[model samples]
Target: MKLKKGINIIDQHDKFGFYCNGKFGGNFVAETARKPIEDLSKLFEKLRRSKKFLKKRDFYFKHYLGGETPFFKLNNLTKYLGGAQIWCKDVSAINGDAHKAYHATVNALICKESGKKFIAGDTGAGMFGKNLALAAKEMKLSAKIFMGTKDISRQAPNVKFMREAGAEVVPVDSGSKTLVDAVSECMRHYVSNCDTTHLAVGSAIGANIFLKICAWSTSQISRELKRQLIKEFGEIPKLKLINVIGGGSSALGFWNEFIDYDKKHVELIGVEAKYAAPLATNAKVAILHGAAQYCLTDKEGQIAETHSLSAGLDYPGSSPLHGLLKDTKRARYTLASDKEALNAFKLVSKLENLRPSLEPAHAWSECIRIAPKLKKSDVIVVNNCGKGYKDKKIYIENIGYYPE
Candidate 1:
């Protein structure tokens, strides 16, 4: 538990820490901007008694980056979209069905290693909720899931899985009865249950542990993308832009390591739901619920809202790191509506025979919109977040059926 020179413990008791670069004022808590000693080992030891979560430091790496995920060239998509070239980092097939599994599984491990009794989380019954439940069962830990009534009503498939996985699903009927309300209710629960529960943030927000795990989990795509592009094209082409966002974990998973890259060569885009646009609507930083660091919130204290068909993106704010990226003008932020997201979802299913998670496809939808404006020689990588298995029933129920 001795203090390390370059590593800063972001969460003292959770063994959540990050490496600090000398620049940008070194490492410190985003709220107090205070540095802490490196005592993660002691914290890890204390948490190791749980026997439900992971005690192994390399578990995440072994599980996430250990396998070969598809990184395929989008010959058909590029021609279809009329872009230079399109490629997908196929996170759709990650364990438990979504890229969120990468983060959730690691988080459950962290919760177990931290001696946390139970894992609590909120969801719209999307990949995040399902992944957490799956991970909890895999780790032999109990899980409490807060989801919106509407999400439960709509996302029945995921609800079944959550129940099957032994998760206690609490439905939020308050407020909008949607993703936002579910997250709010979950935060309220976490605040009251903080002593015994470790709120496993679905994405790279909420707690520092998410950022660490996501950075490592999603880095596989970026690393593979670079290698694949090089092998295919004989060189690492200028990464004109990379677009995706969530609690900012998905984007951060790829973008965090490349923070210092040449800004002119690569562009980063963080897409938000049009109804809950934190980066675009609330540029001024504020602390979001359940966190000490600043985030995007409205004057009324709601997370800046966005509108999207994807329940996964119903949050009002981006992670503070995303806020920092936005403030520094290091990333471009955009908004897409539910209509656009649904269109993209259907388009992907029809064209690629791939039904992506609504969230990642939301970002890809923007890429499709912008493709015509780009040069034909350019290349783009889209984070294909999750499979649409959980969403198919809802799609069928709402739209009747897909055309053959």
Candidate 2:
């Protein structure tokens, strides 16, 4: 099927790519970067005018970003925490059970339109793989997912979800046996199968074009946060937006809307696992997973091994934008230990009846630690990126059983 004009699926150029330290990294075809609607403002306008586009948009809205996720002040949990008005953006409430659902749906739509019959990619905790697999099923495309053996074990539920969604999950047993290795393997697969397959990267740390696409697609979170805050507070409140940085997609999405605003009024905090705190400790610029960025490495410059209770946070590198943010001080980078994250997980479940996946639990850990030091009137928004159902087994084995 010939695609519409202005949409080039196979072209690769730096037209919409990102630069780091004045060097070009990678690029993506413009067609896949912007899907469904060409212009942001014309989304509703287009939906109103075109029944075909509206049907497609409604498919995504109903199956992916239904906009029903809760965005409200966690009054009970906030009072229990004792300082700051804590608000939670419940991304887990999305269709595929995580924020990755948005990007997965967008990429799948692109693949379907590009006339690709096969889709391939890698995942950290399997959420992206699961979501992508579901999208492939809906679009009648074959999916191949590469996941670290370690992640396969820790995120078994998500692996099962992927398989059930008709995806083939391949385990990578290479260096560190984690997300980075899976990324390498997926890229190799994409290189060999480029004609019939498309690699839908799950993170913001990949090729420059993909980073832009994922960040742009997920930026809806920031847009909604702005609107919700205004409605709840009668104006936008001074907020310290906190998100756990795996490949930095959530942070990039959460901060995209606020980028042009005054930096002092809104603070962005990116929390990484203490076991893999490269952004906070040694954010030296390096290349990994096709993009140049700050990565965790050894003296010999080999990618270093990292450990985290959350498989999603076990990556050894971060997105280039995150590195730039660290250098520019636009966002503060911090670390949360496994103990702290687990404690926050238990606290949120007990106090608010919400079970956050270990990934965003890192952000919750940081918020709990810092909320007391801030003014009572200050607002703190935590990007609760994923639900905790997938972590039940790991949580039971590592942290022991929790009472109902």
Candidate 3:
């Protein structure tokens, strides 16, 4: 497929990051972002260890959601790999049964705290939308979820959950009818509706401020991970953190607490779905969906359409934070084709007796490739980013079965 029917260029020297109101160097908010960018930027700063907000978030995530998520070993897979010890940071048990719950709750609470009655957001595989809708309900706010029509079909369970929670789901039929388009629709709505609606970005992508908000919500994961790691191994071991990166909420979160450690000691690996692998494919640095980051763009600089078996990973752009990491060589990215991810899903489900969403399946695909090469002293942690129950149709169609 000739993307946009133009020459395909690989941009290896591109810088990955964005500026907000001269906050980070070059404030480059898009026209659609003018209204809320400043406020959201301020909100990001205000949320830094603020007692009231942190207390509220803790109540919501702990007593309301569940307690801390479990980080445990995959004994069967570890033994099967026969080299590195493999483990799972299971975010699937989050309140919304996905990592998006963290961002959804945080941003939605931000909305309520700001006295906004409505939350506007977007989703790909529908998990974000579902979680945002649930957050809106809990916070006594209304929600509008923009999702591609194609995603609405594949992610019916989440769509149903969103509507049942009283969120309005708008289906974008244009473009690829996927995540990027849904993101565009949501942001465009923000331009006109910022007064009463807070843009609750459900992942660590999109506009710079939104990215900060999402990343902040997920930082708790890595903090908990640190404690779990110490408890599990008696100390932090030579480890690799591998996770599937769509918008990168989970991957970034999985690594956040450990980022201060030396890369030689704690390696970070990101697995992107093949066609949607901007980091792996060497995408150009461009402003897409309001953030300057590695984007799969046509010659005209317009976002190119991307595809993946996993709806959550289907996007033309990636998180700007990921771009900066790539530029600095702190984190490396790899690609997992749909076939490999599906096969990984089958392998893990049968061996480990766990059902993984397709996104994490991509990480498992990478683990399968590299696990045998590492020494037994090295530990590999793959993030289980979402609940597999939402992928019932995907499992039935691709793998012939969906675990009960």
- Find the 10 residues in a row with the least total lDDT in model 3: 1-10
Better of 1 and 2 by lDDT: 2
Candidate 3 residue spans exceeding 4 A from truth:
1-27, 30-32
Every candidate's lDDT = 0.64, 0.79, 0.83
- Model 1 ranges off by over 4 Å: 1-66, 207-217, 292-306, 397-400
- Residue lDDT tens for model 1, 89-161: 7777666676667667766876776677698888764677888898888888999999988788877888888
Q: What is the per-residue lDDT of model 3 for residues 101-218, given as tens digits with 9 covering 90 to 100?
A: 8888888888887878888999998999998998899888989999999999999999999999999999999899999889889988887888778998767776556787788788
Query: Who is ahead in TM-score, 1 or 2?
Result: 2
Candidates in order, TM-scores: namely 0.80, 0.88, 0.93
Off by over 4 Å in 2: 1-16, 23-59
- For 181-243, candidate 2 gives per-residue lDDT tens digits of 998898788767766787788888676656766776677688788888888898877889999
Candidates in descending lDDT order? 3, 2, 1
RMSD of every candidate to native, in Å, equals 6.0, 6.5, 6.3
